[model samples]
Target: MNKIVYTLLIFLIFNHNFYATNYYVSNNGNDNNVGTIDSPFKTIQKAADIMSSGDICYIREGIYREEVIVSTNNLTFKNYQDEKVIISGADLITNWLPSDIGSNIFEASFTGAETQFSMLFVNNKRQKMARWPNNETDEMMMPEDVKTGYEDCQVFNTRSGKNGRRVKFPNLSGFPVDHFKGGIFRGIVGKKWINPMGIIESSNDTELTVTAISDDWGTNSSKMFTDNGKGFGFIFHLNALDQPGEWFEENGKIYFMPPVGKDPNDMVISAKNRKLAFVLNNRTNIKVDGINIHAASIAMKNTNNCEITNGSVQYLWPFFTRKGYAVSKTEQGGIFIDGNENLFKNMYIAHSWGHGIFIDGGRKNKIENCFIDNIGWIAQFTSSIQNFGDGTIVTKSTLGSSGRFHIRTNNKIDITYNDLYDCMKMGQDAGSIQSTNGGNWGVPLDLKGAEIAYNRIHDCNTLTDGNKEFVLALYLEGCFNYTVHHNLIYNFKTDVVPDGTFVYLGPRMATIKDCYYYNNTVWNVDWGLRVWNRENRGDVENILFWNNIIDGKANDGETSDNDRNVNSLLAKLSFKTNIRNITGNGNALFVDANQGDFRLQTNSVAIDGGTEVSGITDGFNGNAPDVGAIEYGSSFPDVGSNIDPEDISFELISDSSTLSTNSSDLKKESIVVYPNPSNSLIKITNLSNNYIEKISWKLTNLNGRELFTGKALTIDISSLPVGVYFLTVNKTKTFKVIKN
Candidate 1:
């Protein structure tokens, strides 16, 4: 079917509404029973078949153990009561016998199809598929040891010596060599960012070969090298199941080593078979709340005004093809939604091998106060949140210690007040919050009016071997008409180099024009801001970077146009080529940063040093506007929300925790500066005697320019010009010292 015609047909069908009704389902009821609170239907599918428009299906507390297929419009599916409504795809396994191949190993035959599963769970935890180097290490085998080719689909050479289909490194060697003839090989071939799984077709002591499991990697990884690149190899076979908790599968037979002396019959082993939980097509005005969706994915397409709140979708590995090939599961994840005005709030999404929540195309959709973590452990997955729609808001949420939160080819998006960290664990060249132009898809898209503000983004792109892939806290490539303000971007560390920075603007083949970077605080970062201009596309022009507090370097490329910037804290603002009306001033400031606080002190020079930005700096406390994210006299601006990301309660909780209390917390009397707006000299007092004994002080202006450095509490500023200034008493404390 044609895509455009199909989309139009779905839109027309979803435009109408009908009468509403409520139905119920339970585990104890039979399929033939009428769906009611007292007499509920047994199967979820049976209730879904008869559901009409605006109908509500309440699933009672119990494990339904079936894949729900939704074919109705404006229908709601939720838990009938406060008890758990677990919709699971995996079935419990119990039959077991001792393995004849090994002493402690056990075998179990499954009644389900042989191709039903490649992953297994014991006690609700994913079991290891038997890999070597038992512990993950920073060092992988060098690239020179291995060579890849697609023709053999099965032929390759490894310098590491352990060959054929099984890996027998010097530190690790066992009976796994005999099982390599027909088993599968899953290895991290190069850079550890991509894993290729293949079936063994032929093997020897030093030579091995297999067909590629994933389509993303054809014959070999394009980035793989015979010398400089590196990766690890994993072997999963019954012979390699020497450790407890390890498992292997062949045909309909499964092998396990029941953790020490524990019997396999006494353990609960589950294997996921079905794929989807709720497959909604052209559905609208529905809500699925307080239900537990496990081991399955949900698909909602062409839907409007739908919500999935206070619920969870976890452990979803839709395609566990153990036949040794890469599974391209891009369109599948915990939740796949494409429509308008959808809300996914207060949800707990975790432990998925693929994306957590994928929003393809929608408008005014929100993913708020949700906890998204432990997603995309394998590099093949897309990760946390990938939204390719306009007017999407991901706010007041905590996202990712794994996978990247990315936005691509859309506009009018607001990503604010979220705590994002420990990202890009499996992939590279990205950040915790990243966006790019839609032009890469050969389509015209607008990025105008897009805002990325008040976000606490950190610890991005931390994975590396030897290559230099620049990562950022906020990465905007080929985007324009964007406003990035009041963000706290810091602590971007790399193992190889401090090459990545807080912000990376303008890609080599793209343009960044008319974008404003204002009032942001950046510290402990290599590059405060990096902007580039290339001759192939449009130049970086008309960028207004003002009132930012950066304690790092700034690099603007030669070919870029004028940057209308002022009140920045770097030593010098660099623009190699001179463009007309370029203004860079008041840029030397010293922020006495203690911990993560970048607030201006009472008498800091930056308090009122910045020139007024017409609409940007409207809410000021003093005569002139203050630089950086927080204004001195007014209430401190809050960077991230205080809502616990792991909070999954289904009640109405106030978001008042998002407010900041920095001023009250820092008003300690242990370190105090006296003399109100005085001239030249000032007196300092310390309630704590130990604080006065060994104290060092420094004074600086708001532009981050250091004016004084001494240990004495009494300092003479009378000789200097009268202005606003900040005085630091100790390394950990900052006090406002004014000079009249």
Candidate 2:
């Protein structure tokens, strides 16, 4: 007995470091089993190779195409209870057939050869890749000039009865035109935000040379004109695969159509060759719940206190070649958090070609009550949440059709109380809440303590094509101390470029100074608080556009010289010259600018009017502080209001309910609405005396469309259409009515 075998090997290594087990993965288990819960274990990287830092893996339900790389830290990958895991990266084609020249097409044969499928799926939806004015009225234009420098070559003509890029039309139409060389051509350049994509290199039928692999027709090659021929097209091969859920591939052969009644050998295709499907590198106190993260790309590199709640990252496509025209493309979409106190709650990131959450650098990160939609159409910095991080927080979220709201060079960030609407849609001059502050690794960083409060930013810039495409709902450029308060920016549409805006600050070359725009509220805008700068960059300083209520137009001077303000409004611009100590006192007088309420009624005239500026209106009500940003009696700040300050304290607070109140502190006698812009009767009283018997209403217009819902006290907008409408009462107070 060699001393009883050295005390039995130190008691089996202290019982394997004091037990902490619970690992069971499946997909018909078998990685040699033994991961308990009834012998499970079959990939999840073999239960992350025997998990350790406070282990706890469950995974059960089916489909686990795999690609998880985690380094390990308080790991806890859940999903054993309500089952339905699904962590795919694609791969399940099921030998298809029938295809010798269409009948509704159908084929599928790939030898793998290193995998390169652009994405396809059947029994789980998602297909459409083959494009080209395929219905929605076949849209197509652009007849003249589009011949680019030849530095890499590019040429596009079309328009003139179409059927050119190889022609076939009449009925379901055609376009195999000899597979048009190499294929790609996406169109819509010159700052309509972005659509760039050219590749063919040569093709007859109506011009289409293409070859410019890089810039693709953006970065402002003089706005790269195509005029306004709208969203031109042409994606994969197989003659743009004539309609019906489209699909196409070439070489490795794929071609599809099915959707008319489905059949392709009883569905279930799936084809996203994996770019990512889970790879939390640096690792930390991890916790990923609910799970449904399909088709890859979900990184969190230098990760810290990680946490991704509820979960859902559908069809995430990550593989960008050049979606930028001005800058912002490190390749992100469907989660790409760099690291720090992370927490992405109630998540739901959809369709992505780029950006639905891409935070570089990182500090106190937090993207709450999340829900990011369609997201960036090909690029232009793309965003549903793009924070350069410092003390980040994007709250009560609901972002729509993305691409605008980039926010570079960070400091103390907190973009609060959300409900951001439609958005830039595809890139133009930009702004659905865009921010910039010089730079860093490249030098320039300027912005400090920031806070864009109480949001409700409405139907935003839909690619306004005035000076050739520009839009803003709140686009701040340059730098400095901040506090742009109590927002409720309304319906912004100028159609063919009347030049949109509801707040556009300047310093394009970079350098905006100290700020404080109090009590904000702007309506159907075409321009309402613009501050330009252009030549040599750096003249807009010490600003303070106080107590606000601008019914569009408050511009502080200076136009032309690459900053154009053509055919102007706000009644022929006149807020003084080259601008300096900016100051616009106590504003109010937008009493029902025809239903789009900028709140201040009560015989209006902007109530107390305003002129108090001490720590910026240190809580004023009557005879003094009432020009704008809401103080006709208070109730509109949002989320524990105090004009927002939980720790980015730039200091100073005399407390008028934390500067112009409104975090559900409702007053001004609760709720009441009368003729207030009526052309056909309107009335909605509820003075909070509490007798309330079913409120709920909605009357949207200005392109948010709802036209009218029920549960009213009196409603009848004489068969609608007078422009500018929105009533939303019970969905949580929204008023501004005037059918006149």
Candidate 3:
């Protein structure tokens, strides 16, 4: 522990990369053996403890049910040679016994010392907890799955500091109310957010009382679902555990009702006792690859320059943290990077009541090509990714689910070339990509920079109470100084908030000012733009709207100026009365608006009709700036993420025609099917555009027989006869090639 000795140890540790050691951990090995590939260590931690910089741990196949924390820097942890390695936070439950609860019911004593468990996994599948509106299928919290609606409840006898708020549910409810004294109240409680869950302190047939902590809100009978509506929630008790695949915990015992009609004795039942499978506790330059993590998460706390790719994290349930939504190991399901310059790419994340990838601090972190969906299905405060920091970027990713997109905290981010769909699938009062910022509340302030461009957001149709609910693709509240351009938004628009809209800018509690909105295309929606100043006590000023196209047959002609390009659904851009500081025109013409193409056409009125901004219109194709996202004559860049599992680096094919422009003056086409005389297979290659997996390709013989079809990054025609074949991209452009 002396100064010179410690400094010398640090020097040797940092320089150990020159003679890096290769350690191994296998389920079949022992810890006493040397850390070799043959005589591997029994646990991953055994290698992690002795490893310094540049040490590699090759984890062998099989599930290791333990939490491994790596505090060493410049380390590599990966599976050994395509072996299926799983780090699980769950322990196998073998001693299942019959329970007196009912027939086919079984109970197991709590063996782990964790005191409470949130998830019960049967053969790696998560089971539903005991509650009313029983999760009938894997469909999540769909409206039909739960018929319970908000009731005329009241919140009173409110106490601060964990006593929470006491709510009374009236209307003379039936059932033994005293037996549900300790049940939980899980409800939306009038707000789209805010899942006020608490224990039932006292109850009677006339009114059941429950307590919810936090002063987020308090409600009254007439105010249920209203602004001040406090009594808008439902309750569930342990006594309601009567469905298949349902389980509950009570008195330090775990109970289960077997799923798929399988007996507990015959199924691989496990309890999630450990919270995390891997913890990168303040380590740097580490890599975790090709490992499957079940019933746990990877918590990267305060680490930098780390990477997690080619992996997955599943079966993350609620790990409730007391006193605000605190960031901790308990609030993890997918990979979480809480540091700077970290990267999580090519990861598939699903099923959690938390964020898939949470950037808990302000730094330049990123998520690339990750397919994150089916998350936040349970309640509020969930998103596919939540960036609480500035300079965060999510690119080439497909994010969909019942939850929100990125949980914005007055933060700056770049959301480009991603596919977002099915947003607000089971929740409400939110947008697919939303930011509720600039309030008197103590959230972060002035996160005023977001580059939202080139993304495709659609199919945001979710139902509640058998009626279509309103969803927003881009909803920025109390936001300022943002640039939104070239993004394609469709289908996910609702005027219920005012008059129909695809993009919404609201001056809520804080001013919506100094934002540039231009070159965007909205189709199949009511209105292309909606600016609401319901909370206009704060100013709405300096909004620049330039070269936007709003089209589609849904709004054929609500007004005269609403041409096929400017559909008069709510007069193009619906602005609240007396709140119009917006400048620039929101009208334009498209090449083929009927087919959802927003590119400008020759002789269109939009050409040279707009102003020129510095960075945006620098590479204009026409005299000035044309209308809409893509320029009329310019080559189209690919939109959305390529989430294909088989994607990799392919040698770029040389084709001069693929780089051509689309204008009449250009001689060549912008996109082309390469290698006109392919030997076995051909690739539809575009030099200018990003790699797109959903770029459809179809192969057919001259006889009109379809040889190959479906979404393709590349098609294999090596098995076909040596003849000329027709290849189509998106069924719009067709090219001929020979399979020799």
Candidate 4:
């Protein structure tokens, strides 16, 4: 049992034992001595109230603004050794007076346990929350406009005046018309992915008018605008709290403006009353190691093999209410995983407003080696890991969400090797790793042995949701089959998400759904792959691109004279009919991939040139597999956390260690289509005539969808499935069969 609880936690830390199961916790101690370690206990919920089930507490150092309810289980809190500990949730603010400052505006007062707030930290940073086109600097959360890349997604050309609940805005002329009277707009209306904030019921300069305060704002056609669709500010309002760290609140006072000019009595502020800093309620194998956990979060209810290791879960409590409608569940702010097999390891999670780790369910949960960043700054489609569950196992985590949204799931997931980046921020048709095919949410997709291998997904940029068949990097829509390999999906912080961005291979129904996309590597990314079929429902005939290294470079968007490949996304979205199942070719060169280092340099053209596939290139280093997600003189596998690990298991990589034996590239591909009877159908034969008219083929299974593609040297695999399958060539060989 974990080596008998680490040998009784090494005999209660080298013999300081008395069998009360070690407790302590301090700021110099005293919740009534006797909690040992020279009698500590000044509230870590008073040693989580008389510790029990495998007890271990230990805390120590300082800063602990309460809220810790652990219905005990196999416990073990930790910290003592590092002596850093912290668990605050704001709540300091002592005295400000100078008649409550001004212009440098400052003031305080609010003790009814402080009425309400979304944030305000001062010395700990994070201030600005006023708003009204107000942003002299200190860029407070969203509203950075600057893209004359010819704006006009039509939302009425930047809102040209509305009706019912009125809107207007499309002029500026000397600003100030009661600075957005009693503010709160936060736009992006007429549904360009619902941004919603509303409630300005009155203004002038350019025109305003809103009231229904919520419920998607009582129609002006549900807050109209759609031609360049979203953009608006207004917010908070105390006459837009004029710059300098801004903040606002009225009546019972509480205003500020010190993000730097100091002396609100030499700053230390803090406001944001405790909101459950660490609950682990209904606990089980509990283990909140290494402490830290600032602005508060962490509520693993129905908790199970619990374990929140390492440290830092910073700032959290972001936007719990801006008056509702459009996104809720009290708008996330990180860490909320609900139960079973939990174990958020090596944590670091930051900012938050919308998920940094939501996964609100139970089942093999395991977001390992965490480093989650910024996060959907305002419920921006709750990516940054939201809705993950059912055997979820996002490994080696390093997820970053600059423009928001990075993961939206439907279930049975296994995302490995992680390092994901800026997802479709400002949101739209996103996909920094998004999944669906739970019949698009009516939930039911469990496509058996799934596994999106060796991750490195990159920038799914956004200039207002970068519309171009919607930005990319592993987007899977009607998700079929599923064993996407050795990942590396590439770049783009701009070039405005050009045509089909990257990897879309969707599949809804049309019977035969598969996916085993091979030895991956995709750079620059602008249609490096895409095989659609959603309308007139599914059928792209086995999407293929084996031993991949798919390349893409120069592009400026708006379909710069079409033809970006993957048979031009099935002949320019004219659905199906592009017949280009691409095989490796000069391995699309990389090594510097403009500096994201996609490995494979000297004599590049993809070293060992692919075709391994046995539980994914199992331990190979040369003369064979080598495409993306690192392996050209091997290295890059620590995508985020794992310095001596082993203890995971969340199902994938089905059986016989992935079968498929024998090779010399499988004796030059059994001549072709060879799988020794068992189901049937394979072609090529005696391979000569320069390998039968310069070979080219694409089947599909191993769960990545597509059954028989072009340059067809014959294929049928009669209803397929038995184990192992692959066969590239002239893009550069790759053969590996087995089946029976």
- In lDDT terms, which candidate is top? 3
Model 3 agreement with the true structure over 499-568: per-residue lDDT tens digits: 2346655543355556777777676665545443332244455667776655543222211122222222
Model 1: lDDT of residue 565: 34
Task: Give the lowest summed-lDDT range of ten residues in model 4.
Answer: 650-659
Residue 189: error of model 4 in Å?
Answer: 9.7
Better of 3 and 4 by lDDT: 3
Listed per candidate, the RMSD to the true structure in angstroms reads: 21.2, 29.1, 15.5, 27.4
* Per-model TM-score versus the true fold: 0.71, 0.34, 0.72, 0.34
Task: Write down the TM-score for model 1.
Answer: 0.71
Off by over 4 Å in 3: 1-16, 111-117, 144-179, 201-207, 213-236, 259-261, 319-335, 441-445, 461-470, 494-500, 508-513, 526-537, 551-611, 618-624, 633-636, 644-740
The deviation in Å at residue 252 for candidate 1 is 2.2
Computed on alpha carbons, the lDDT of every model, listed in order, comes to 0.60, 0.60, 0.63, 0.60
Give the least accurate 10-residue stretch of model 2, judged by summed lDDT. Answer: 650-659
Indicate the residue-level lDDT of 70 in model 3. 92
What is the lDDT for 291 in model 2?
73
lDDT, candidate 1, equals: 0.60
**C-alpha displacement of 285 in model 2, angstroms?**
27
Residue 208 of candidate 2: its Cα lDDT? 57
Q: Pick the candidate with the highest TM-score.
A: 3
Stretches of candidate 2 off by over 4 Å are 1-25, 29-36, 39-86, 93-185, 189-202, 205-235, 238-252, 255-288, 296-374, 378-401, 404-425, 433-466, 474-517, 520-580, 583-740
lDDT of 2 by residue, 52-91 (tens): 8778888765567778887778778887664456677776
